[model samples]
Target: MKARNKRLILVGSGVALLVAAVALVLSAFQQNLVFFHTPSEVAAGKAPTGKTFRIGGMVEEGSIAREADGLTVRFAITDTAKIIPVTYRGTLPDLFKEGKGAVVQGRLEGGVFRATEVLAKHDENYMPPEAAHAVEQAQKAAQTVSQ
Candidate 1:
């Protein structure tokens, strides 16, 4: 091949490889991406079903129930406007408590959230941004309805 043709081929091959790399990176990113939702959104069917996602809210007061197995527990998460039932079969964080900010990662199954992981607020003054926003919105909505 002529020198000019060789240069064009090299450039074309490099572009193709780069495009392939970019596509792979994008695909991986999409697969790993997880979305955060609130109890209201999940109840309204805004959250995707059968896919891994996260829900953030307060662990409703007096909703925690532990089974005889001791490892399995069920509770309800609430945003003041809505509630979602969650079941987890593992050790909970020390900070996990009813009426406190909590986030659970799991899939919605048969009207319940089967949590694979749970996260709790680190301090009294700290809550996840998504949970805080959800709680704020719920309070505003409640006020609007009472007026």
Candidate 2:
């Protein structure tokens, strides 16, 4: 083969290998990419089932029930418009209380979220980052309209 042709082929092969590597990396990272959804979104069928993801909402008051084992707790997460049942088999965070914000990561099974991890709002005024941002934007828009 001509030297120039060989060089072109070599460059093409390198480019193909690089593309393959990037695709592999992306696929691996995609599995770790957990998306956050609200209880309303989940009820609307927007949440991924049989796949791990995060759900954020307020712990519905009077909806928490502890199993006899004590390590298993079942509760309802709500976004005021909708509610989803969630089950967690671990000690909950101190801030995880009724009427507080929380984000649970797990897969939905049999209409209940089987949480592998749970994160409670950090402070008294805490809300999930996405929810807080949305609330902020809405308030700003309302203020603008009222002015």
By TM-score, the best candidate is 1
lDDT of each: 0.97, 0.85
Using Cα atoms with residue i matched to residue i, what is each candidate's TM-score against the true structure? 0.93, 0.78
Off by over 4 Å in 2: 1-10, 133-147
Instruction: Give lDDT tens digits, candidate 2, residues 47-133.
Output: 887899988877889998999998999998876666789999999998899998888999999889999998998889889787665
Query: In model 1, which range of ten residues has the least summed lDDT?
Result: 121-130
Clash count of each predicted structure? 0, 0
User: Would you list the clashing residue pairs of candidate 1?
Assistant: none
Cα lDDT tens digits, model 1, 96-136, are: 99999999999999999999999999999888999999999
* TM-score for predicted model 1 compared with the true structure: 0.93
